[model samples]
Target: MTTRISAVPRPAPAVDLAVPFADCHITSDAQAAVLRVLQSGWVTTGREVAAFETEFAAAVGAEYAVAVSSCTQGIELALRSLGLPPGSLVLSSTMTFCGAVQAIMHAGHQPVLVDVDPATGLPTPATVRTAVQAFGRPAALTVVHWAGDVADVPALAEAAGVPLDHVVVDAAHALGTYAGDAPVGSGPGATCFSFYATKNLPLGEGGMITTDDAARADWLRKARLHGMTADAWRRYLPGGSWRYNVADAGLKANMTDIQAAMGRAQLTHFPSWQRRRAQIAAQYDEQLAGLPGVGLPHRPAPGQGTHAWHLYPIRLRLNGGIDRDEVIAALSERAIGTSVHFIPVHRLAYFSQAALIPSAGLTGADALFGQLLSLPMYPRLSGAQVDAVCAAITGIAHQGISGKGTE
Candidate 1:
């Protein structure tokens, strides 16, 4: 039986407006899609999920795509499928979400943090070389498409002296990102994408792993569903039997049909959303240009690749009179929310253990961490909100400092 809920109305706040750093766009079609799934009675990984996987694979130009519960699980499943020996070293960026390092560790590997490019907060070919030169050859590397800017995969592989197959891309922020003539997932390595609430293609909470390797694809299919030879839908089909076989012990990381329905709806509307995001990014670039002591996010020249515009991370000149935290507080006071993209992985208490990641060599990451701040960015963010955000920032730059800047 369905329970009826009563509506509750509240008075508006005293502030002009409250602008969040990011917001999900849930279309009417998305709501209907979820309702259809709920009415279908088959809410697990079934027809809806199968269709989403197929359509998503085609969109990303990949041979196969496996939907998972989250990008973190997708990364772990990809790494586990590699069959790497225990204690294998996985080189990853220092300026990235904890999910990457946690995935490496969960997949029975040790994470060696690599410094990022000081300008863009991304790991470069030189960063890979430095990691290899310092830590010796890693069994695999987990490269992030930092803030949706495509990494130079070929150059990075050559520098690391590893084949392209040894790399797994954490493209959590890169759904519409392109690398040359191909999409981000249409490469030699496994690519993981997030559908978190704040991500480009928000599905509330889900992820996908795409790869061209048929063997790995097949393995991941089974690995995401408890290593069963056949999924529940397949077994329950008309001519199918309930019998199945266990291949290997796998984690439970399958995406439900309800989530897939939401994803499918979002996919249909993705192009328009992407276009709006790009437009907003352009406005930020034009309006926020040459603001004293502020560095805009790095954008690639035309034909190099396309950025997904997942974040607009601006660097605060820490040595300048204003401080990053003070700026954040000032913006908050103006009813706008800002966030820091990351704290260097080396500084985190768990990862700080000398055994996991040595802290001495992460000079670039450490330096970038103190300066980075993520401005409000999302498809639905209005021109007026963007204007107010910029004005608040400019005002803070003028008079936000109370004393010498905090390093």
Candidate 2:
């Protein structure tokens, strides 16, 4: 008997047809927005940034929304406004980006760690309680809404037993996610929303800090750049003096009017963009169901809150013959791209030692990390492309053997 070779090869599992991840989806509105800023001549920190700040605050239902260069800077500035004593503990959930931890550290405070809800990988009342018990009374609490899922924000704030001022939300992923009738920023001390290249309201790079407190808002606006008593826009306005006061030493983190122009354009498309994201997420949920080793990203109940669908993170189930890594590799081979929402702030080498990780002593972050996988999700992602990605996942998920390639 001779072994014969077949001429036709296996169709590389339908060559990944999913649309590229991180598509900015800038519309014709972007051109007009940019042109308006350009035509004004006075770009940099001008009327555009100020206008964007005002509009964004109104959009988020906050009394004030200050624009900044980046979400990390926004978080830092928010923490600085808190003015907690140096070395004081600033508690925050562990299952989050390193920026939150970096903000706390740079604020000259001790970062205390808190774990998140086991199922959703979001902060919960219990996690907050445990953090308080473990880390003691913190100078403040940094509440993070990871993966666009609003955590038990109110509950966590209540459990902390601190005044509302102690709450500072790193809501980079919650620009559009809401709890109850309020968006992520409302009812908390301050919530920082990102407008990064991959965010729901991508603006190349920018962020907003929404707050109800007038004093804090004023301080943040001043603190973003050298703690000047007045902003550059004010100085350059007609009849305004170049003379200004530096109340405190601040960092250079102000957002330019050009970036704000992009923000304004993105905001116009926000409602439709979010709808598209939700639809894509729903499609993923429907198409990926019952695929072995793959669990669709959990969605919060509509009555409980509004979900922005900033990320569609599926946890690769270990029991499935195909593990997370193998499936991810298979998807990669087909051209579908993916990323882990986070590696857990405490786990990152940059903030490892002496860092306050919300899940420091627990297995919470570790458990969440072991199986997490974020699928490509964006307004530009097409229905057919979504289907192709889902089909690839479906095939890989069903294959027997739990491989580590998913995350």
- Candidate with top lDDT is 1
> Per-prediction TM-score, please?
0.93, 0.91
| Model 2 TM-score, 2 decimals | 0.91
Model 1 per-residue lDDT at 217: 92
Residues 1-407 of candidate 1: C-alpha lDDT, one tens digit per residue: 21111122434443444798778887899899999999988999999989999999999999999999999999999999889999998888888998888999989898888888888788888878778877788888888888888788788777777778888889998898888777899878799999999999998899999999999999999999999989999999899999989878799999999999999999998888889989999988887788777889987778988999999899887334456876676666677878887988888888877324543578888888888899988988999999998887765554433322333
lDDT per residue (tens digit) for residues 1-407 in model 2: 21111123334655434455567666788868888888988778878988999899888888888889889988888888877778988787778887778888888888877776557888777777787887687778888778888676667878887677778888889989988888777664888889888898887788899898899888888899889987878988889999999888698999998889878877888998889988998899888877766777766786888878899998887443445666566666667888888787777776677775444465777788878989999988888889888877665554444432333
Stretches > 4 Å off in candidate 1: 1-17, 318-320, 400-407
Candidate number of the best TM-score:
1
lDDT of 2: 0.79
Question: lDDT of each structure?
Answer: 0.84, 0.79
Clashes of each: 0, 16
- Cα lDDT of candidate 1 equals 0.84
